[model samples]
Structure formats: C-alpha cells, structure tokens
Target: MWSQTTDKQRNLERKKEQILTEIKAVQQLLKTEKTKERNVLSEIQDQNHKIKLSQDLIRNGQQQIALINRDVEKNQAEVAVLEKELKALKEDYAKTIVKSYKSRSSQSRIMFVLSSENFAQAYKRVQYMKQYANYRKKQGDEVREKSDALAVVIKSLEEKKVRQNVLLREAEVQKKNLEAERTKQQGLMALIQKDQRKYNDQIKKKRTETAAIDKQIQQLIREAIAEANRKAREAREAAAKAAGKKTGEKVVESSKGSNTAVFELTPEGKVVANSFKANQGRLPWPVSKGYISLRYGDQPHPVQKHLTIHNSGVEISTVVGTRARSVFQGEVLQVQVLSGNNKAVLIQHGDYITVYQNLSDVYVKKGDKVTLKQEIGVVNTNASGQTVLKFLLSHNTTIHNPQSWLSGSN
Candidate 1:
C-alpha cells in the first residue's frame, strides 16, 4: 500500500511536469505564430492546462510545507531533549570538578591515603580515587558529545525553516500565475462568447470530422474482431474433429456492435482475458508522462456551460514525439489511418480490445504480437502544436473507462 501511494504521488508530479512542458511548447508556438491561420483554440487550451497545472503545483507545495513543518517540530523536540540531557551532564561534571579542586593538592592526596587504617585500605582508597577520576572524565565526554548533537539538531531545524519559507514563497508565485492564466482563459471564453454562433459552428464542424474518424476506427476494429474470431473458430473445429466430436459442433462467434466488437475466445483466449481482468487497476499508462486532458463518458464542455461532449475514451496530452506504448501484452489486430486522428492501432488480449489512436507512425501491423509497454506508435503533433493520444479499452461491445484501469493517480 505504501509503495502504491508513493507511486501515485510520483505520477502526479510527473503529470505536473508534463503540463509545464506543454505550457512551454505553447509559449514557443505563440512566439512563432507568424502564419496566416492562427489557432486560437490551441492558445486557449494551453492556458487552461497551465491554470490547472498551477493549481496542482500550489497544492503540492503546500503539502511539502506541511511535511517540512512536521520535520522542524520533530527536530525542535529532539533539540530540547538533548539540551536537557546536556545540562544535567554538565552540572554533574561541574560538581565533580569542584570536589576534585578542593582536594587537588598532592600532599593532601598522600595524607588522605596514609590516613587509612591498613595498607590494604590505603590501596583500596587509591583505586577508589582512580575510579572517581575516570567517572568524571566519562561524564565530561558525554556532556561534550550531547552539546555537539544539540548543535546539529539546531542547525537542521534552521534549514527546515528555510525550506518551508521557500516552499511558501513558491506557492504564492504559483497562485499568482494561476490567477493570470485563469484571466487569460476567461478572456478567450469571452471572445468565443461574443460570437457564440461562429464558435458553435466551428465546434460542429470539428465534431463532424471527429465522428467520421470514429466511424472509420470502429469499422476497422469490427473487421479485425471478425477476422480473429474466424481463425479461432477454425482452430476450435479442427481440434474438435481430431477429438472425434460431431462435425455440427457450434463454435464461438464474434459479437457485433456499432462502436465495439467482442470476440468469443477459445480456452487459451479465455485465460488471457481472465489475466487482463485480474489486472484491471494495475495496468501501466499508455504514455509514460502525460495528463488526461479529456476523460471518458459525458463531460461538461470546457467553454460552454450548457453544452456536453461525449468521449468514447480518454485523451492524454503529452509531449511532442512521445511514443504511445501498450499497457499490456497483446496481439495487434488492426493498424489503420483515420482523418484528423492520424493512425490508430487496435490490439486484442483475449476477449478484450485496446485502441490507441492519434498516432503518426505505427510499429506493429495486424497479427503481430506486442509485449507490455512496447512502443506501438509515435503520437502525432497536429498543426496546432498539440500532441494528444486517445485511448480506449473494451470487453466485448462495452466500453470501460481507461482511467479506472490505469495503475497511477489520475
């Protein structure tokens, strides 16, 4: 549990870093936007992403400060304990020194030993004096050691205070940045609202193109599933005939649907599906470093208050040129191109299918096997300077939220 928590924290930090990288990419594009067609939507998206990132950074910084404060308090407590111990040690040592000073004379010491009742008594007295001296020396050394320890603790406390102050200041800076970015986003929203009809038209046009691309991807996946099921059926029939089973034995077929297709698997395929199901919440992310810009299911539109958008899968915003990787081992069933989404790769594991879209280049073709975390393709960076990958997971014809299947914090 502790390891999983730490991994989640690290994933959150990585996501923040990826957003920062995206902000920088947008800044560079804005600086170099000398072209005729300006992508206002890109700028708005960048600002919105940065605003969200800044808020996350502020929260992380505050948490860091709290952790540091705890350390400081702990150090302070330790210093107090050491101080008390050192003081007692010093007082004892001082008392011993004073008593020794009063009996410091060599003549006095000789008389004290001579005054013993017998030679044996005198020898014992001498031994007692030597032991007292050793005891006092040990006490003094202890006092010195404790004093050093206290000093070190004090220094550490000061350092923690300094770190806390730095974190506080950084949090304040992030808040300011967030405010500015939010204002910019609001301005963009206002501009869109000023000509709401035109903006709506743009959205409709984009939505139509996206729907067409989705249709093509769905068709490709359906065909791939059908083909795979055909092969599986053939293998099952051959095995059944060899086992002297009836020729009329029924074979499993692929279930057909509009957006998803589920293949009825053989026993081996069933095992694979069971394994994939067992790892539902422990699957690695398709992209190593990125943030979910858009999640699956219906969501309120980012700019329009009364509008809703449906996403079949989550969209991950990542750095340009980043490779899209497989979350688990599977067989590539389809690698096809779609308008605006670039290339799409669909892989099947047992009865389940995972689709990775918006790629520029694909590494595996149909029927090829892919290992866990294998690079499937390079995510395409569009003309707007945004590199986003759309990922989907399905069991049969039912879609599953990719976020729920991922291992790390969303």
Candidate 2:
C-alpha cells in the first residue's frame, strides 16, 4: 500500500486486501463446487451446500458492511470525542474574526497600531494578532478535513449496503437452485432403486476397500511404533555401553519415553479437547478450502431422505487433487489403499486419532511423525470427478467428526 508513503495507509490497504480475498475465495468455492457429488451423498449434501453458500455470501457482505459502518460510526464518534477541543478553537476563531473585522472596518489600521503603549509591546501585539489569525485558519481547515472524511466514510457504508443487497439476491438464487437440485436428486434416488443391485455392489465394494485400508493402516502403525521403540532401545544400550567404559559400571536408560501419542477421542472429541487446550476457541481447517457435504452422525443421503445412514466423518467437497493436511501434530498409525480409487490415512495425536479417508494417495507411511498442518495425502475425487474428503477424528477406534477439529480452519 505504501511503496512511497506512511504506515496508516499501509495498514488500511492490508485490511482491505484480506477482506477482498475472503469474498473472492468464497465466491470461487461456490462456482467451482459441482452438483453431482451432492446427489451421490443424497439431498442432505445438497441442502447443506446451499446453506454454506448462502452463509458465505451473507457473512462476507456483512463483514465488509460492518467494517464500513464502523468507519462511519468512528467518524461520528470522533466528532463527539473532540467536541470540547473544537469548541474552544471555535471561541478563539470567533474572537480573532471579530477583531480582524473591527480592525479593518476602523480604516485606521494606523489607530489600531498606535493603540500600543510602547514600540516593543506594539510589535508583539501585531505578531500575536497574526498568529491568532493563522491559528483560526488552521482550525477551519481541520474541521473541513474531518467533515470530508466523514462524508467519504458514509458513502462507503452505502456501497457496502448495496453489495450486501446483491449478496442477498445471490443467496435467493442459490436457494432456488438448491431446491431444483434437491428435486433432481430425488429423481436420481428413484433411479438408484431401479439399479439397487448395482448400487449395493458399489457400496459393498466401498466398505470392503475401507476395511482393507483400515487393516493396513493399523498393521503399519503397529510396525512403525515397534520400529521407533526398537531404535529408542538401541540408543539406550549404546549410551549404556559408553557409560560402562567411562565409569567402569553398567549405565541405565536416561531417556525412556516413547515418542508416540494417541488421540482416543473421535474427531469431534479431539476438536473439543484441542480447542480448549490450543486456541481456546478455534479449530484447524481439515482441507485448505472446501464446502462440507456430509456432517457427523446419522443423516439421510442427498438423494433419498428415507435412506438414512450414519456418518462417522464429514465429507468435504472441494476441487480435485486438493491435499489433506494434518490439523495438528500426530503419528501416522496406518496408510492404505481403499476402494473407490481412494486411500486412507490414520494419525494419532494425544488422545485423538484422526482418520482421513477417500484419499487418492498417501504421503506418510505407518509410524511417521507428522506435525501440525502437515500434508497427508490428496483427497480422492468421487465418481463425479470432484475431490471429496472423508475426514474423521477419533479417540482410539471410535469416530469423531472432522468439523470440530477444523473449526479454527474456517
């Protein structure tokens, strides 16, 4: 903002850019999100998606509008805050103006000059008069500057309200579009009935693949933990051997604690725990940017409301190839290829076990230590050719909702 000027302008421009970027990102997410994945998850996905889009629009508009309103209010508040100061200035200005008018009207600018008692005193009074005039001029200039700034702020507020109006209109369109999508999704569900056998097979394959992946992850983790423990043991023995030579006596283990951590809490549980333990309120974003599709617990599929299924994790919809990263530091217990052309990775953090399913590939193997915000794998796109992440946070083997841990990510 200020390649050439001051700090205030730079700070103002930085805030502007942050707000603008959020607005643009939300808009783009809405545009890029596809309709097919919503159908696959059932109407529940579609409804939530519509709601999310509306929320983003409303939120962005309201945020910007609020900032503008704050500016206007600040201007008004400033006027009030400085009223006493300005009042005194006004009195000084009034006296100066009155004196100047009389001195000029007398036509004997000379009589005014001769009114002085002595040469030094007369010279000093003239100088004082000129200084008072300049002070009055400065006060007038200040009032004008503040008034103009206030007007600009009010105008900006109007523009923000206008933008909010547009956002509302967009939200309505999104709602109607959501309704249309819901209806079409219902049709698709009916079609699923006709192809129930095929759909069931698909579901069965998905479950099998998931199970296989889970087993692989557990096995890999066990091996990795063992390996870590083994290495730690070797280091201890090595130190013992060195100490034995130095002191002529056998040495004991100095560092015996294992580096492994486990979060037995589900995603939601972990999120809650971490929220209190970490940021006090915020959760990390599971993926960089995406709309949540399936939420935690038993919810109807997007296509058929009658077809209820329990969701252990949230399915987040985003652009293809979007990488899934660790919301917090943890150890990789398992990574395996699941069905549906996807992979799954499980990590343990504290008492929390985070499970990220529906991945295209895994980056970390079993026993690998991953830090906060570490990339685990790219999200696997569904049949719709768009990335959909099945995110779960768990304690031990029990499921946790991904949303809680990623609350801060939003």
Candidate 3:
C-alpha cells in the first residue's frame, strides 16, 4: 500500500509538471496576443484554456497532498509500533543484563558447572550459559535494528508533512490565480456579450469559411487518391504488356469508376501505412511547442455558447514564426493554396495522409521526400495575429482525430 501510494503520488507530480508547462505556454501565447490587435474571441478562448489548465494543476496538487497524507499517517503508525517494540526490547535487554551481572563472577560460573551431578548434566549447564549469552547479544542487536527502523519511519513522516505543507501552499496560490483568470474570462465574456450579435455573426462567418476549406481539402484528398490509383493501374498494365500478356485491357477495365474512397496501396505504401498505424498515440507533434486551442469534431463556441463549431481538424495555437514540421517521413503529395493565400501541405504515408494547413510559406514542394520533424513550412499568423496550425490526419478521404494520434499532452 505504501509503495502504491508513492507511485500514485509520483504520477500526479509528473502530471502537475505537464500542466504547469502547458499553463506557461498558454500564458506566453496570451502575452503574444496582447502585443497584437486583440481578437476578443481568441483571447477568451485562450483565457478559458488557461483557466482549465490552472484548475488541473490545483487538482493534481490536491491529489498529491492527499496521497502524502495517507503515507504520513501510515509512516506515523509504523513509527509508533517500532517505538513500542524497541522500548520492550530495551527493557528486556536491561533486565537480562542485570540478571547476568549478578552471576558475573568467574568463581560463580565454575561453581555452576561443579554443581552438576554427571558429565552430561555439566555439558548441559555449559550449553545453557552459552545460549543465554548469545540470547543477550541477539536482543541488543534487535534493539539497535528497531531503533534504526523507527528513525527511518520518523524521518519519512516528517518529510511527507513538509511536502504536504508545500503542496497546500501551491494550491492556495493556484486558487488565487484561478480566481483572477476567471474574473478576466468573465470580463472578456461580458465584452463579447455586449456585442453578442456581431460576434455571433463573425463566428458564423468563420465557421462557414472553415466549412469551405474542409470541403476543398476533402475534394483534394479524393482527387489525390484517384490519381494514385490511376497511376497504379497504369503501372500494372505496363508490367503486363512487358510480360507479353494480353491483360492490359482487363487491368484498365477493373479500375474504371472505382470509388476513390481508399488508396490502392502498393507494397511499399502498405509498409509505410502499417508503420504509421503502429505509431498511433505516439507520433510527434507537427510543431515543437503548442496547445490545441480547438479540438477535432464538433464543439460549442467558446463565447457564443449556442453556436456549434465543427472542425475537420485540431487548431493548435503556437508562437508566430513557428516552423511546421512533418510528423513522419513521407512523400509530399500536394501543396495547394487555400483561401486567404494560406497553403496546406498533404504528405502521404501509404494509404494515410497527414495535412498541415494554414502555412504562410512552403519549404518543400510536391514529390519531395521529407524526414520526420523536417520543417515543411512556416505557420501563418493571421490578420488577427493568432498563429494557429490546423492539423488533420486521414486514411484516404476519411478524417481521423489528430489528437488521438499525437503523443502525450497537447
């Protein structure tokens, strides 16, 4: 139970550290936003994220404190038991020492052996004296061991108390910070509410624009899949002709009008796809530092609560001028320009494709083979000054939640 509690506390500490780091990142991003023309909605969302992280840090600290308290109680109990045992051992040893001292004289020991009736009785008496001496030594050793154990338990209890106090102080500080952030968030919300209609319209317009971009991305992926399949079919037909088989016509007919929902992966493509699948939940983030400001799928608007916002991918908020990197090694299949002159890079890993969008500048072109974490482009800082990378993962035309594939904390 003690070890289990320690493990749990350690895990909480690690989680607390991660939360603190994310909170710092969010604060930095907020500072950056403050320097630029403030986008109220974005600021509110960032504030909300900061508040959530602060709450998590406080909660984690509380759990750690709870675990420490548990351990402290357990250690105190153990110390008490050891103290009792050591006291009894010392008392017994003292009594034994006094009794042995009374028979300490060499003449008394000789007399004890002489009093025996026969040789066997004398031998037995000798054995008893030796055994008593050994018992006294063993008792002394046990007393020392118990003393050491009690000291250790007492020290552990003291340390746990210290840790508990530290965590309580941290929690208090976090609570104060959380309260301040909540007040700030409310003020931002009030600002939005004052112009609620205008913000709502803006949000709706943004959602519509996002929808259009998502549609274009979907169409581009579908076309890419079709083109890949067409190339594969041509390759097969050419191979058949080279082998002197009249199978080119059959090959071409077989691929006609086939739904381009899935890629016709070659052997090499299959290997890459398998490797990508194997690394699900372990892939590196496309950027070195960021947090997911908007998650995948549908979520209510941060400020306009009644409005629903659908995202085809996660929006990661990061520092401006951050270079977007590839999550895995793959061939760049396409680099298409989206609305607002923002560009999207699609890299194919077998049947799977990973998209990095909202890039301001491209670093690699089509057919370029990029290594893991290779910088593909510069992330765009929009007119509002928020630098967000819209990242998406898909198996051919079907989108998957990128968060599920990303490693560790956002």
Candidate 4:
C-alpha cells in the first residue's frame, strides 16, 4: 500500500513540472511582441520564431496530457478490480462468522471432547480445536487487509481525477498561446506591407536628393581646385631660382609626372568606415520608427509583376517628419537639395559611406564629425505627402546589404 502511494505521487509531480516549462515559453512570446512597432523586420522574424516556440510547447503539453490520461484510465480499471475483490472478501468473511457461531458452538465442542473414550482421541480433538481457531484468525486478518487496500485504491482514483483536471487546463492554455502567436504573426506581416509602400517613396526621394547634392559637390570641388592652383604657383616661383625651372614649366612637369597629388588625410571618411565596420550587427535604425521595405540589391517588388530591380540602399517608410539618423559616426560629406524638393546628406565613416537621402535641408558640413546614431537630416515629405527615407551603405565602390549588417531584431 505504501509503495503504490509513493509511485502515484512521483508521477503527478513529473507531469506538473513539464507544464511549468511550457508556461515559461509562452511568457517569452508575449514579451517579444511588444517590441514589434520599433523594428518591423526584427519583429516579423521574431513572430515567426515565437510561433515555432509555441508550437513546440503545445506539442510537449499534449504529449504529457495524453500520458496522464492513460494513467487515469489504468487507475480506474485497477480501482474497479479492487472494489470487486473487496465485495467478495466481505461476503466470504460473513459466511465464516455464521459457521463459527452456529449450533455447533463452544458447548458442543466441549461435549465432543469429553465424549472421546481414549487419551489418544482426546489429544486429536484438542489439535482440531487449535486448527479451527487458527483458521478463524487467518480469515479475520484477510478481511482487514482487503478493506485497507480498497480504501487506498479509492483515494488513488480521486487523486488521478484531480490530475486529469490539471492536464486539461494545461492543454487549454497551450492551445490559446499557439493561436495568439499565429495571429500576431499575421499582423506583423501586414505592417511590413504598409511599411514597404513607404519605402518605395523613399527611393524616389533619394534620386532627387542625389542630383541636388551633385551640384553642390561640384561647386565645392571647383573651389578646392582653385585653391590648389594658387598654392602650386607660389611653390613654383619660390623654387625657380634654385632649380632653374620656370613656374609654368615646373607646373607642367609636375602634372605630366603625376606628382601633383595632395597628401592631406581624409580623417572623416576613414572614421566612418572604421565605425561602420566595427558595428557589424549593431547599427541604428535607418529611418527611426519605421520598417524596411525592400532591402539592398536585386529583389522583385512585392506588388509588381515579375520585375526585378537593383538597390544601392534600403528604403524605409516612416511617419511624417521622421528624422534620418546616422547609423555610425562620420562627417557630413554633402547635403544637397534633390529633385522634387528633396534633399540628402552623405556621412562618411572611415572607408564606409552612409547616404541618408531625401531631406528638406542640411545641418552639418564637410568637416563636422558626427557620432553614431546622430541625426543628419529630416526625411523629406514631398507634395504628395509620402514620408519615406532612403538609406545607402557603401564600402568604397562596393555596396553592402544593410539588412545583414543591422541587428537581427529589436
């Protein structure tokens, strides 16, 4: 009886522990969904992960519940068998009591012993009495043992019933969590679609922005060229007497020899590149409070028909007046007004260059050092009122996928 009770207790504890583990996984899913708004790409992926986790949890819970159900059925069967045995034992015990108390009671037993004529017969009678007493005692003990066992079986059945209730509740909770995660996944996908439209607007804005910056860059380069010429002339005149080379001739020779190169270090571009490389998986969001639409490189448009296009940078659609922030530290290389009243700011980090295009105005200039996540410009919302930002990353001439470099999920 004691061993049976111990086994039942152990089984219940095991099933309870399994359910607890499943509940923890469901909690993580709930927490992950809250961050969906800040990072759509990450949230979408995270939702997919959460759904998988929920499914696994549900699978485990169902298995445990099924096992427990089988155990309950077995317990019921055992209880029925034990109850039948107890009924038979009670009837047999009643029959023994009737026989022991019949007319052949202790008076007859005493007379029978006295009627024995020889000592041998008397001794045999005495042995018979002792045997009958032992038999009655054994029967009484069997009845007590059977009754005690029946009580234990009844209690076990009750405990199993309680366990069944617990299992049902655990299964129900797992089912609800699974459904909730899938619904959240569908919602996230819809948001991505909405964000994609915003991203398209960002691309168009970028083209306009690049054009505007090109003009400003051309004028700046021309000024730098003029300054170079003046310095060259001064150096040439100073060296004329010593080397017997005319200023004009020396300038021509230097140009022909390809020796008229500037040795000035571009600390800004180098810094941006270094910072960008250093933060392979830790770059800030391109368009704050937005989602990535189409990533960098060739990808078919979500709504277009079998058409593919190349992307130098990613498009992020945002709410109106969303500011484009720097993903890494760099100096403002150019801020140009693009076509369609758009603008762009090019921030250089080391060898890496980040272009936040489509803006209304520029804030920083050529030599100003910007830190990581610094705001470069506000994304331009065109006449049509489309709010999108174009984000581009390039290491020298090679374009990089911002998706791969950015954080997986928020």
Candidate 5:
C-alpha cells in the first residue's frame, strides 16, 4: 500500500511539472502576442488555455499534498508503534542490567554454577548462566534496533510535512495566478463581445476559406489515388505482356476503371500499408513542440457559443520559425500551393496519407522519399502572430483524427 501511494505521488509530481511547463509556454506565447498587434479573440483563447493549465497545476499540487498526508499519517503511526516497542525493550533491558550488576561478582557467578545436586546438575546450571547472558545481549540489541527505527520514521515524517507545506504554498500561488488570468479573460471577452458582429463575420469568412481549401485537398488526394492506381495497372499489364499473356488478364483487370478512388496496392505497397496501419496511435507529431490549438471535427466557437466551427484537421500552435516535420517515412505525393501563398505537403505511406498544411515554404518535391521526422517546410506565422501547423491523417480519402494517431494523445 505504501509503495503504491509513493508511486501515485511521483506520478502527480511529474504531471505537475508538465503542467507548469505548459503554463510557461502559454505565458511566453501570450507575451509575444502582446508585443504584436493584439487580436482580442486570440488573446482570450490563449488566456483561457493558461487558466486551464494553472488549474491543472493546482489540482496536481493538491493531490500531491493528499498523498503526502497519507504518508505522514502512516509514518506517525509507525513511529508511535516503534516508540512503544523501544520503551518496553529499554525497560526490560534496564531491569536485566540492574539484576546483573547486583550479581556481578565472579564469586557469585561461580556459586550459581556450583549450587546443584550433583555434577550433571552443576553442568546444567553453567549452561543456564551462559544462556541468560546471551538473552540479556539480545534484549540490548533489540533496544538499539528499535531506537534506530523510531529515529528514521520521525525523520521521514518531518520531511513529508515539509513537502506538504511547500506544495500548499505552490498551490496557493497557482490559484492566485489562475484568478488573475480569469480576470484578464473576462476583460478580453467583453472587448470581443462589444465587436462580436465583426468578429463573427471574420470567423465565417475564415471558415468558408478553410472549407474551400479542404475541398481542394480532397480533390488532390483523389487525383493522387487515381495516379497511383494507374501506375500499378500499367505495371501489371507490362508484366502480363512479358509472360505472353493478354493485357486483359484477370490480374490486370482490377485497376481498369478511372473512377477507382481507393488505392490498388502492389505487393510492396501492401507491405508499406500494413506497416503504417500497424503503427496506429504511435506516430510522431508533425512538429517537435506544440499544443493542439484546434481539434478535429465540429466544436463550438470560443467566443460565439451559438457558432460551430468545423475543422478538417488538428491545428497545432507552435513557436515562430518552427519547421514542420514528417510524422513517418513516406514518398511525397504532392506539394501544392493553396490560397494566401500557403503550401501543403501530402506524403503517401502506401494507401495511407498524412498531410501537413499552412506551410510558408516547401522542401521536398513530388515523388521524393522522406524519412521520419524529416523537416519539410516552415509553418506559417499568421497575421495574428500565431504559428500553427494544420495536420491531417487519412486512409485513402477517409479522414482520421490526427490526435488519436499521434503519440501521447492520452
């Protein structure tokens, strides 16, 4: 039970550290954003994130305190039991010592052995005296061991108390900070609410733009799939000709249609597809350091509760000048320029595809092989001074949440 509690405490401490690091990053981003032209909605969102992190940090601290309290209570109980045992041991040892002192004379010891009915009895008496002396030594050792144990438990209890106090202080500080963030968020919210109509229009326009981009992306993916199937079909036909079989053989018949949206994988392509599928939920992040700013699918807008925002992919907010990296090794399928001069990189892992969008620049061209975590392009820092990488994952044209595929999503 004690070991389990200690493990829980250690885990909570680690979580607290992570929360603190996230809070620090949010603070730095907020500071940087403040230096630029202020976007009230963005500021509110960042402030809200910081507040959430602060609350997590405080809750983690409280949990740590709770574990420490459990430990302190357990140690105190142990100390009490050890003190009682030590006290009894010492009392018994003291009595033994006093009795031995009164009979400490060598003459008295010799008389003890001699007082027997016969020689056999006298030998038994001598053995009894030796055993008595050993018993006294054992009692003294017990007293010392118990004393040492009591001292150690007391020390441990003191240390736990100290840690508990420290966590309490830290939690208090976090609470204050959280309250301040909440106040600032309220102010930002008011400012946004005052111009809510303008902000809402802007958000709708942005959503329309994103929808168009998504449509373009889907079309590109379809084209890429068709191209891949065409190549596979060509290869099969060539092989059939080499074997003196008609080009209309059954093996080459599967890829005949132009409307085949899914990939017709070759043996090698099947291997890559299987490998990619096997690594689900363990793929690396598209960027080295960032937090998911916007998750996949439909979510309520941050400021406008009535408005719903649909995201085709997850948006990761990263530091400025951060380069987007490949999550896995794949062949670059397409590098297309989208609206606003932003670029998107699509890499194909067999039938699986990973997309990195909103890049300011591109590094790889079509059909180029890229390794895992290879830097592909710089993520664009938007007008609001936020550098975000919009990442998507899919099997053929079926979209999957990138967060679920990325490592440490839990």
Candidate 6:
C-alpha cells in the first residue's frame, strides 16, 4: 500500500514538471520576435500555441488534484482506523488497571495463595497472580504503542489535507489562466475575422509556398528513385556479362501521370527497404514534444471557412530551438536550402524517404549515416515566431501520411 502511494506521488511530480515545461515554452515563444511584420496570421498562430499550452497545463492540474484527493482519502481512512484501535486499546488498558488496583496490596496477593486448600493449589494460585500482573503490564505497553501510532496517523492525515488544499488552490489558478488565454485567443480570432479578406489572402500565399515545397520534395524523391534504379540496372548487367549471359535490354517500369514511381533497388537496398516498411507505425517522432498544427491532406482553414488548405505532410509546432531528429535509421540523401525557408533534410531508408523541413541549420549532410532519433537539425523559428517542423513520408514517389507512421501521442 505504501509503495503504491509512493508511485502515485512520483507520477504526480513528473506531470507537474511537464506542465511547468509547457508553460516555459509558451513564455519562450512570447519572447521571440517574428521575422516578418506583425500580421493577423502570425498573431493567430502565436495565440493558438499559448492557448494549447494553457489547456495542457489545465489538464495536468486536474490530474494532480485528483491524485491528491485520493491520497487525502486514503490518509483519512488510516487515521480513522488508528483512532478506533487506539481507543479500544486505551479502554482495555484502563480495565486492566482498575482490576489490578482492586488487588493492589501485596498482602492481599499473599492471602490469595494462603487461602488455597493444598500445596499444589497454593502454587497454582501464586502463578495466577504473577500471570495477572504480566497481563496488566502487557496491556499498558500496547496502549502506549497504539497511542503513538494514532499520533503518527493523525499527523499524516493533517499533512495530506494540507497538500490537498494546496493542490485545489493551484488547480483553480490554472483554470483561471486557461480561461484567460482562451478569451484572448477568441479576441484574436475575431480580429482576424474582421479582416477576412486579408486573412484569406495570407492563407492563399502560405498555401502557394506549401505547394512549392511539396513539389520540390516530390521531385527530389522521383530523381532519387531514378538514380537508384539506374545503379541497380548497371549492377545487374555487370553480373550477367561476367557470367557470359546475353544482357537483354530491360527498362524499369514507370508510373505515368503520377508524381511518384517505384524504386528499383539493389539486393542491399531491398533489405533496408524491407526493414523500413516493417517498422511502419512504430517509428519515433521527429520532435521530442509537440502538437500537430496541420495534418496531412486537404482541410478547411482555421480562420476562413471557405478556404481549403492542402498539405502533403503534418506540420508539428514545438518550442523554439527544438531539434528535429531522424524517425528511423537512414542515410541522408539531400540537404536542400530553400530561398526563403531555412533548410530541409531528406533521408532514405531503403526505398522510403523522410523529409524534415523548416530547419534553421543542418547537423547532418548528404550521404551521412543517421541513427534512429538522431538529431538532424534545429527547427526554425519563422518570421511569425512560430517554431514548426514540416514533416513528410514517402515510399519511392508516393507520399504517405506522416501521422500514420509516427508513434501515437505527443
């Protein structure tokens, strides 16, 4: 029972620490200045992060309060049991004292033995007196022991109550903070709605930039697949020629009218591809902790209901300077630096490709081997002061939803 209570306390501490970290992250974001002029879009993004962190903190506070309540209840029950036991012990001890006092005289004890009819009877009478004295002594000791235990339990119960009260107060404070942040977010949204046209224009411009990035990524995947197939074909031809066999011309199949195509790999590449595919949904997250700001595929804009946004991958929002890591063990295929966007790292795990974009700098380069969860680069804090990573997954040339591949939860 004590171990379980201790475990709960430890878990509560961890959750509290996590809440603190998120609060700090929000504060950090607030401190950062957007690279571009302040606009509704940027303001909305910043406020959205603040609102998210506040909500998370509120949840943590709720959990903490619940844990404290359980502890308080357990301690109260323990106190009650101890009090009852102590009371019974005290009564038993008092009864023994009263009975002993009634026969307290040494002379009376001697008379009790002398009154026996025979020597054997007298000896038994003396032993009975001694046993009674011992019983009384034992009862007194037990009462003392139980009294001490009750005192300890009472102290513990008091402490638990104090802790519960503190937690309740903290939870109330967190609720207030969450409410305030939510109100602020609502105000920001209303302002954006007031200038709906401007907001829609900004969203359109962002969508255009996103489309451009997706195009570049798809093109890169296609080129890499073509190159891998070429190498494999050459290797096959060399082996055939060495065996004195006729090398018939065979062309790799292409997927026409599609941006993606299958990658033909050498024997070694096939093994890597197989391993990558086997992991599937078990892949680690690119960032240590973050939430998905934009999910894969087309979705309505947050501010403009009529506007639809297309995304090739999930956009994860994290604290500034958060390092983006490799989801799986792979070799870096390319390190691309966009005109406005910072940089992007493309990694190949067999025929599968993972892209990490919106990086401020690169820690790994082209052809460099990376291990699973290895830091690839730091995520960029954009002009709007939003630190986000645009992550994509693809097999050969076909794009896959990264959320399906990444481990569940933040």
Candidate 4: C-alpha RMSD to true structure equals 15.6
For residue 184, give model 3's deviation from the true position in Å. 1.0
**CA lDDT of each prediction against the hidden true structure:** 0.79, 0.62, 0.90, 0.62, 0.86, 0.79
Worst lDDT run of 10 residues, candidate 5, spans 246-255
List model 2 lDDT by residue over 1-410, tens digit each. Answer: 22432344345446545544543543444444444443343333444455455445445445544554555465456656566555666676678778677767544656666898999978987787688668878878876665566566556556656755765675476567656655754665667788777766665565565456556555545554545455656765897799799989966665555433332243554565565357422546768876666677776655445555666677776776789998777777677665556677877664556778878877899879888789988887655555678777655444555676566333
Model 5 lDDT tens row, 279-330: 8889998998877878899999766778899998999888889999998888
TM-score of every model versus the real structure = 0.82, 0.54, 0.95, 0.43, 0.95, 0.81
Q: How well does candidate 2 match the true structure in TM-score terms?
A: 0.54
**In angstroms, how far off is 393's CA in candidate 4?**
30
Q: Write the per-residue lDDT of candidate 1 for residues 144-208, one digit (tens) a residue.
A: 89988998999988987997888788788888888888787888888887888987777667667
lDDT of 2 at 261: 37
Candidate 1: C-alpha RMSD to true structure equals 4.7
**Hey, what RMSD does candidate 6 come out at?**
4.4
Q: Which TM-score value belongs to model 4?
A: 0.43
Q: Candidate 3 residues 114-214, lDDT tens each?
A: 99999999999999999999999999999999998888888888888888899899999999999999999989988987998898888989999999999
Among these predictions, the greatest lDDT belongs to 3
Candidate closer to the true structure by TM-score (higher is better), 1 or 6: 1
